[model samples]
Target chain A: MTVAIIHTGCANIFSVETALDRLGVPHILAEQPAEASGADRLILPGVGAARPAMEKLQSAGWDAALVAETRPLLGICLGMQLLFETSEEGGVECLGLLPGHVMAMAAFDGGRLPHMGWNRLHFEIADDPMLAGIDEGDHVYFVHGYAVPVTNHTVASSAHDMRFSAMVRRGSVMGCQFHPERSGKTGARILNNFLEFGA
Target chain B: MLAKRIIPCLDVRDGRVVKGVRFRNHEDVGDIVALAARYAGEGADELVFYDISASPDSRTVEPEWVKRVARAIDIPFCVAGGIRSTDDARTRLFAGADKISVNSPALADPDLINRLADEFGRQCIVVGIDSREIGGEWRVHSNTGDPGKTRTETRATLEWIEEAIERGAGEIVLNCMDQDGVREGYDIKQLTAARAVCRVPLIASGGAGAMAHFEEVFRQADVDGALAASVFHKQVIGIGELKAWLAQQSIEVRP
Candidate 1:
């Protein structure tokens, strides 16, 4: 199966690229969503600012192409953030595919912001293909400042500053707050799962 | 809740793994593939290869070696050394490096940082800074072009760091050359200065003696990750133990 890493010229694209490389899954570095349709699954990787990301997507004509597809789309950090209706990171509105809002991660008791490190996942669905082989309490690597709340669209949530959406999958579209590429073997399992699920 | 990170630093020369204190390793410690597998199995967050070849002539070896090493480790592997342009970064990324590290070129031409960020994206471009304290002030130092090329004094640490981030270096690697083999601890002051304006993750390198040093860097610097050579090489601390120690310190680590 082929998976396309939807590229909008954001940072961390190579990390995603490397993750796919390790998995040995053929993937296209799709500059636009049209190239994405060639693959069974699509990955939206987040690495840079939301404002510029949206601008690049618009400029690349990815918006229309993305909307036209019904295939599985997995979103990484900023990739997940952009799936929401809007994000506070940038005033720019997002894809509005998922019915949720992106807000800053709640303040930790006394810790600094930008919740960085590995944490466990509590799934909304008992058996999720995307979460295959990942034990219920297994820790997944995360590096994000803002978060997507546990709205109706949130499929999984984890406790941090406040309980927040850690994973979100909705009708062929998926997202993870963590960088699966950087998360090691467990993360690879997740990426592999995505690949197996027709990526 | 955020996830913890585990990293393994690999010193590669002529496609072989070597380890030593002060850039010296006794023998071929182990196969890069085997060690990479061990790190991946042990739940490493990422892997980094610092190419320390005597001459900069055979630069393509690292990326080629990365393709081979990439097969062994499932974790993200970053490549350092002789990476100065977007083309070089592209080659490495295509060859299987998760991130490409840039140093001299970033400082020599301020715009190269942003240009690279715009071209390859910011997070893929890691600006590796080798610094040393002179007169109680940290300064950026460039690796001599070759073994014969002399190390040149560059701009102040913080000043160049500001430009790096401004130009879109997604991450900063503070490689303290003086403390590289000293094994005392990282330069917390230098890390703090970079952290003040560093929007991306800060990886603290150089000067790690024991697990306490890891704790020191994590606690004092509040860095996203800590990287060291001698400690990991000499088996002072295993990846799991280091993560456990950080966990004991109440730092959320991957279990």
Candidate 2:
């Protein structure tokens, strides 16, 4: 039942930490890659640029360890972007845990660059454990410029300037472009589902 | 498409919530955490706690109070006021504020915006502008806490918005001093000037009297969010009822 939040040392992990705290879920802040193995699940949380984030991960040996994570793992926002092969943001390489590339959200269509605020979701699958009890049109808060392309792994999609993957999943690994922790009650449910469901 | 957001602002002074609200079933009516959580339950899209505390001592209480409120609610909340450096912004974020809103300090040192955006990402940095109509034009003014003399001097409003965006400001909050507390409505002319140059999301602040005012701002101005304090604080308008009303007006709002 132990959950570890991987601290990318890039963006503030306080919001994610606060969410877990409110849920009363026992968790640890895994600063180093080695610390991640002790937990039953790992949550990679981020919110800043990819290049410096990637460098931090590489320095902390998380780049190698993240690829080796056999436990159920979740990546949020910039954390989700880093799980991809490469990012158009600063032209940086990322952990190749998932397929497709990270491109500017505006590249899909010219809209607001950040694509921030709360938007509804259209779930690809009606019943995903990570999205358990969450409805098709439930609104979630988003705040990111770069996004992962809609691929086979995409479990849900949201439209801003154009349609983009809101949530992506590949086996034991899951990633959400929105801040589930900051999306109110529905977000709390998603996080709770993740804690209950195992690899 | 992103639904238009209705944000309730709380004024925190001397590390305590300034509004005294008596919600039924709650013993501590003045509890900031309780009040904030109620707003979140009432479908407030977001919350902003403007720190108006001017005391040099007891600085720790502000961040601690923010932590309590942020922990109590699941939605994003931003902290503004007296933040002059990257360290100050980082402290607030670490205390659980999702974003940092800066005003006068940013006007003084524009590079502080770039530094914060570089460290915390542009999404978390919000540049707050207090502007007033001076002479024949709308210009930016710093808050001086004086009603009669709110406008000390004028800076080019549109130019400042462009410069803030260039400095990596993720969002712009246009607080019209002319409309502030007047409740006439948002300064349409000033907002129009801001919309022309603002590339990021624009949040309209100051001068919201009733539901119609909110409706008018959304209809007239292409702003993303509308923020108000006393209306919500004094229970002049309930967040739930306001959102329902906005929804009925054909304005897309999160229910």
DockQ: which candidate is best?
Answer: 2
- Lowest lDDT 10-residue stretch of candidate 1 chain B: B143-152
lDDT tens string, model 2, B135-238? 87777775433233334445787888999999999999988876776668887778877887887989998888799999988888889999987787778899
For this target, which candidate reaches the highest TM-score against the unseen true structure? Answer: 2
Which residue segments of model 1 deviate by more than 4 Å? A1-71, A77-82, A85-95, A101-129, A132-137, A142-149, A158-164, A192-199, B1-6, B23-30, B54-62, B144-148, B152-154, B188-199
* Candidate 2 segments whose C-alpha is farther than 4 A from its true place: B19-29, B54-61, B145-151
Q: For residues A1-199, could you state the per-residue lDDT of candidate 1 as single tens digits?
A: 7878887676567667767877777878998666666688888987657888888888988777777768888899889888888988757799988988888664334444445556788877757788888878777766566787787767668877587888887878888887787676778888787776643
The stretch of ten residues in a row with the least summed lDDT in candidate 2 chain B is B20-29
Q: For model 1, how does the per-residue alpha-carbon lDDT over B127-176 read when each residue is reduced to its tens digit?
A: 88878788888888765324344364658888888788878777788887
State how far residue B158 of model 2 sits from its true place (Å): 1.6
Worst 10 residues of 1 chain A by lDDT: A106-115
Docking category for candidate 1? acceptable
- Candidate lDDT (C-alpha), each: 0.74, 0.82
Candidate 1 has an lDDT of: 0.74
Model 2: DockQ vs. true structure: 0.72
Native contact fraction per model: 0.40, 0.68
**iRMSD, all candidates:** 4.3, 1.3
